[model samples]
Target: MAITKRGLVLGAAALTVSTAAIAGTGLHFFKGQALLQSDDSKQQVADADKDTSLQPMSMLSLQSFFNQSPKELVDEVWQIIDRTYVDGTFNQVDWKKVRNEYLKRPYKSNDEAYKAIREMVKKIGDPYTRFMDPQEFRNMKIDTSGELTGVGIQLAADEKTKKLTVIAPIEDSPAFTAGILSKDIILKIDGKSTEGMDVNKAVTLIRGPVGTPVKLTILRGTNQIDYAIKRARIEIHAVKSSEVQSPQGKIGYIRLVQFSANAPTDMQKAIKKLEDQQVAGYILDLRGNPGGLLYTSVDIARMWLSKGTIVSTKSRTGEQDREQANGRSLTNKPLVVLVDGGSASASEILSGALQDNRRAALIGTKTFGKGLVQSVRQVGKDSGLAVTIAKYYTPNERDINKNGITPDVEVKLTEAQGKALVANRDKVGTLEDPQFAKAVEVLGERIQAFRNQAPRAETKR
Candidate 1:
């Protein structure tokens, strides 16, 4: 069957590598106008004139003044928080007091109101629950659409060092082509130091119109290098696959970069191709994969698991929603999953599901623990909010939020080893990848055991 390659649209409530907008919230705004009689309209105009603030002014002044009262914006944000914030008690901080505190200040401009709202949201003590201004919201939408005009690198902030670090550069992207290596510390962007810089802010600085150049000062180990890379439109490919010859036989190797919209379909094709080759088993690589859509992860998990719960989500109200897999295993062959520190969110879900169900053995280091889920709510036409709505658990009911998942076969890749593997990912196989080599060895044993246990029939002469 021919599989159609679809665009990688990020679904809502995704455990994303970066703080990209994912999933949708069912919030809608309606604008209604009331018609007034001629006399009533005239009276309203006179009443407006009586109020000096509402009186006629220059077009520019009028535009600024009537851009919806900042108080109204503040109230809108406050209401959303009051109704939908995961913690109803605002984590023991009096939410009403927070609202009153922000409202007490005079906010004549939308920028001021946004600042106030951000401050109020910050009081909740959840970094993921953030306020996205119009521009940030627009950029998030662009990210969800699975296309970006940027240098094409994912970034993360170190919890201890607080340095902006390169997570991974998109394959064939401008950043990758410019030799931007993973784990490179971003010291400066366009001459501005990245010390204490937020990942989203760094993203904003790095992204721009196509063909624009971005200068980056990177610290790789003991050497510091400066790179000038031009931005380009990046179409992210979430799934890649290959076949590697191992001591046992041909091993099917598939790498899932993220659980983007196209992931499940692309992965299905990859598995089908490998099955056609009659590979003994499969190795699913998820190292350096920042997660994407939650549903995409569930879908991918279902491809391997024929039964049992895939994942479950718990909300503040103690409501639990569980997703179960249908009995439709794509291949009954033995499988091994590879993961590392960079694997997170949806990546965790998929690996955890496979591991929990005994469908596959997880290799590599522990994963990045991010079990919380964010729901994206549209605040305005050009603005939105990503609120933490729920926490997800693996099928085994483990919540690996701060504490990550421990791989069955622990394998740690040194910095130099990782750089070498990443530098030649497409060509390098078991020879360059210790994790891959180990997985191949493990799978080879499993295949040999299966053959040894199979019942043999006597052939009639």
Candidate 2:
């Protein structure tokens, strides 16, 4: 719809002219109606005064405003946040004042508008809420779909040292093939140092067109090694399943790398195949999973949970959404979940839900606490914003945000042991893996206890 005179003149949205508009139009007003410097603006204003339709260039179409003034882009993002932002205080930044301040700036280019948006997002004091440029937006969508064109290494900054660290390499991707183990501290991408670099910036630096080589300077322990790894199109099979023979019985082992859209389907197939085989127990390994779609996690949660709340999202505005299982679980086999520092977001949600509901025994170290929910919204023709919309809680109403869910049985791996296991990925779910070994032990104990109680309960009844 075309922006009418009232919409532009009455400050429905305060928009300013970009440098491109100033270069084209001789005289143009930015704050109010975009009046031309010539007598045409006067005539148009006079026409409005005479009670006729005020037809200025801005009244042509809103698209024209979008093309000429990047300030509209600013307002476009501003309006979305202003309307739907869960945080009433906008993370304690005066959101109203921020809009006016940014709108007042003469945006020289779309980049300038994007910069303003970035700074504005930063003022919200949320690291998760960020502006994604066109390329980043595209990559983010691809990432959630279990595909991406990059080195295929998930990265995060150390909470204490704040150094850019590798979470884990995507299985069979370029980084994984290059032997880039988990917990490898990235010193630099190409030649630039990663000091004070966030994950977003590091990602921008590391990723490029497929087949292109991106050199990474990695600090593993005290040794500094340079890896010239070529980027590739990574298609991640997030769920992998196998049957392991153990003392307890045949174990259905499933490793979930990330909660991509296909996770639920894949998980169902895996569980069904294992159930048909009559596996005594199941082991869900969510180690090094960076997480994906929130709904995908909920869907997977339903695959295991027969009933009870799986997760709940509560916005700052008190808008709450709760998900519950509907008795569609594939099997009721004794279950154990494996987690570590890399298990984050959806991983935490799934693990926390299972742990809280007593559906599974968690056997691993603490999880990587990232509980904020983000909504990916398009800003304009291109570019997007990932704004934090809510914080999720487990079935027990535990907010596992920064403080991750502690496992029922802590099987912590030391730095060396963790590095070795990551180096030899084949042993990840086997008895050789200390964490997996502990999971087997815990599952055996639980299975024995259940067996011990079965006869006594039956006789009493």
Candidate 3:
């Protein structure tokens, strides 16, 4: 997939400007500094073998560790592991027995120990932190986020049902070609039942090196269909937009696939074309868009928010930071936005900002409500940790974490309705799609009302 011009511009700008501003600065700097000077702390634990409830291991040992290591990067981690394992009732876990079982053969070095420890952590039944070896780090760096090699389809386990279901398939993907529609109940993969499988485990089974094939059995209605698909590297082009003329030949429709580096430029071009055609209004489709690139979202918001703060970010230091709108502003015309469950993260940011400012009317179900901001911290080569570093508050100071942004108009799409719309665009019914229908109605009203008003002097010129 080719990169959008907007994304390319944003990427270049980020590399030239933000890279210097972000690199070797902020929390990452402190974290890196701390990691370098904590050797004695490790040694103290290495030497201590007894599990005493109340034994002081010597502040001198700690100070000496600090002096010799000069960095506290891994110090806290070392201390936590030591303290937790020593007296924390580790649920009667026998470390010696585990070591004997896993490490029956002689191990080569500390790398083996790291792997063993990682496996032990997994045995505790937590999925959050998995140990990353050098090879994993390399693979992660080469692949972009969310673009895994597998049959192209989105999967999610229903929170209530806890059953694995097909979310959606990429356009022109192998899954799409195989007639795997959304919401199909996945019964098995490679003939292995999915009854007790978690989504991540299923993901692990489905994803592998490119060119490998996997078979899936899905339940559609009362019938079961099998699909054999070859895994291939999938490149997700996160943004797509065009200046499409409305059916009435009055307004222009700009359907944005996702927010990416190229979105702003693509939007600019689309708007320019619409302007040239003397379009009446705009319908911006943000449905099914999982967002990307925070700054790109900011840039798009600047086009609408003429002035004032767009969003505020509170960092770990209790300092509140705000991103102000640049001089760039839109044409001050009627705008309608569409959003739904798939619209999350940066998409929510833009939608919330526009609604807060009354710059646009939002129509759809509640957003995904991920108001937390995460920054990537490079732990090692090609391996980084993305931890929630801050929570963003909208212009109205609304927190959208668990509770997503509520659309001005609520709409739900039925499976039959969606299929009809996708199959024959002419058969699309908006009566059931209240949110989108409302947007169209609202835009029509705006067009009628704005058409009667005197054109702005800037617009007239």
Candidate 4:
């Protein structure tokens, strides 16, 4: 019998499979089995009637055996976690015991097996690590595609209040046109109470077929407002820019909502247009920006940084991977970054790189401090797993996980001031936004200092 390299690899992987070990690794068991080829030349490896006992069979027999039970599907999830979880020892939990406990319970259906799998993953105590069902996985795909059928608003839950709050509405979206402002508390969605509702669940409820309307009960400060927003196909523009005349001269203002697939390209065009207009300085606003793709963040960082480590990742075996800038500096203009509590993940990566390299001055409140990296892999044809594979650090080797990155100039926003800023965000040259106003002031001083320090040329005879 001729054994192929792929067959050998599959056989080795199957040999390592044990009932006691399984859970946090990124493994696609269904897909792996589908890749293996059956040897038609061989006869029946095992007869069901003759052997009723459990025994190791040929590669082809193993595939057939694995498909008969949903328990094997659960075991695949467990084994992946056992081998590839961020913590090698399952965070000191009795992983084998946990596995046995789940196995002991009879799973009558595939749903029960999925529930068991979720319960096993929750034991790891990492919120970022999660098992996504088919619907949840589909929603994730819709979010990343930059176009979705929904009201079109970014949302975040308050840590203290646990209330679902609107981060920002996409420009020209139904939510924005319906007057959904940042910091607005959503009491209910489509008459469904939002109390204690997970953000993802709420999103699922809010999104529906285009042309349908979703009713939202919003709490703005002490007053409550109701709006019926019709769902539409929203195309999110991750980057928005404009040139504003400031106290010094024309300053480039760019607001980065999220580091989506189109962020780098959109930002590149924004920067090029601003530079062409002869802007003296730039302010990159990341306030209320819930972060997105990691590679997009790194690509954006490379545009500003001439040379330095952008970000670093540390894995379970103390393996460290560093992403450094590619020595590409697009503009020498004085740069200032604006961040707040809403900024997270890839936002932190970009801010940390610029601040550590002394390329930009960070101004505003602290960041959201989500420093873990999640690798999403398909479990079966429908489901998937988003596992936290590593913890990331800034260029200065600072791990800002629970503790966020503090700004050089700390400016707190009062409740009333926050409401006013959201209302006037579209008004250009409006100094009512104190944080942005302060950024413009700081950049003005830096630009003036640069001009004064420049060596003047001598007048020719």
Every model: Cα RMSD to truth: 11.0, 12.8, 11.9, 10.9
Candidate 2 per-residue lDDT over residues 1-461, each given as its tens digit: 11222101221211211000000011111123322122122323311111111112234234643454678877777766765466888867888999889999998798898778878776766655667676554443331335567777767556567687776667778888787866789998889998966456677777777789989999988999999999887777879999999898898999998665467778889999998998888899998776755656777888888989988877776736687888978777789999987787778889999999999999888987777765544456556565556678898889887788999988878878866775787888888899999999998887777667665545564
- Give me candidate 1's TM-score against the actual structure: 0.80
- Residue pairs that clash (backbone atoms under 3 angstroms), model 4: 22-78, 22-79, 23-78, 23-81, 24-81, 25-80, 25-81
> What are the per-residue Cα lDDT tens digits for candidate 3 across 107-182?
4554654445455544433222233343332222221222435676656454345567664555445666666765
Q: List the candidate 2 regions with Cα displacement exceeding 4 Å.
A: 1-68, 143-145, 156-165, 177-187, 195-199, 218-225, 455-461
List TM-score per model, in order: 0.80, 0.80, 0.63, 0.77
Worst 10 residues of 4 by lDDT: 16-25
Q: Model 1, range 1-461, lDDT digits (tens) per residue?
A: 11112111111122222323211111111011111112112211111001111112234322433355777667666766676566778789998988888888998787888778777877877766777777666555432325556787767555447677775666667887778765689999999999866555677788777888989999999899999999887766778888888888888989887666567788899999999999988899998776766667777887899898888877687644687888877987888989887787778888999999988899888987777776554453335566666778898899987677999999888877866766776544565689888888888887787678778998999
State how far residue 224 of model 2 sits from its true place (Å): 5.5
Q: Which residue pairs collide, candidate 3? A: 6-261, 6-262, 7-261, 7-262, 34-72, 34-73, 35-73, 37-69, 37-70, 37-71
Off by over 4 Å in 3: 1-149, 153-169, 176-204, 209-212, 216-238, 242-249, 316-320, 422-438, 452-461
Per-residue lDDT over 1-461 for candidate 4, one digit per residue giving the tens place of the 0 to 100 score:
01111111222221110000000111111111213222122222211111111122334435643354557657766766676567877778988998898878887877787778878987876555666666654554432325546777766555457687775566567877777766688999878899966555677778777898889999988998999989887666788898888888899999987665567878889999999999998999988665665666777898888789999877687744677888776887889999987777778989999999988888899987767765555454455566566778998989987687999888888877865655665652357688888888888888898778878999999
Q: What's model 2's lDDT at 387?
A: 54
Q: Measure candidate 2: CA RMSD.
A: 12.8
lDDT: the better of candidates 1 and 4 = 1
In model 4, what is the error at residue 122, expressed in angstroms?
1.9
